[model samples]
Target: MLRTMPLTKNLTLEQINHLIDTGHAFISPFGLNRTAYIVINHKPFMVVVTDVSINAIQLSGSWYNWDELEKMGGVFESEFEALKAVAGGA
Candidate 1:
């Protein structure tokens, strides 16, 4: 059976990694050289893993590149942290 991730709170870094490593995260092509792994939560936030290198959390609207997002304090140490930072607009 497929394991369902809980959406009550932000996922941990380990959990995000597991989702990517186990091919459970949704995969989407970003560009010719990049791929995105997306994890959606019940809340208004979503965590996106880019080519296994960077993690970006999108609360809503369009996506932005790492450089542009970093300027807005959107960059984080991990997917979990990114999600936590954006949770409830914190």
Candidate 2:
């Protein structure tokens, strides 16, 4: 079970915090699943889970650019499962 979520300008910070606090995780094109927090400009950000929450935040370029992160987007289908397997082995 994988799901793709886009962080749009409509989603607010509070709504995103609530979703992670509740248990549903989001998958980015970069393939970071179960990502509770995201670091943008050295600042930590929470993830959004609801449709309404998805419409509350103003997105900035620093958050959207994953190219700076090493090996950020190579993973594709089953990435989450592979990550989980690695975590479990560790």
Best candidate according to lDDT: 1
Which candidate has the highest TM-score of all?
A: 2
Per-structure clash totals for the candidates: 0, 9
In candidate 2, list every pair of residues with a backbone clash: 9-57, 10-55, 10-56, 10-57, 11-55, 11-56, 11-57, 12-56, 12-57
TM-score of every candidate relative to the true structure: 0.23, 0.24
Tens digit of lDDT per residue, candidate 2, span 1-90?
A: 867566677878887888778866454343333233333343334443212122131122223323432123211234354344334431
Q: Clashing residue pairs in candidate 1, if any?
A: none
The TM-score measured for candidate 2 stands at 0.24
In candidate 2, stretches whose alpha carbon ends up further than 4 angstroms from where it belongs are 1-5, 27-90
Give the alpha carbon lDDT tens digit for every residue of 1-90 in model 1: 867443435888898889779977764323222222232332223333333223433322345665556455554444566556556344
RMSD of 1: 13.4
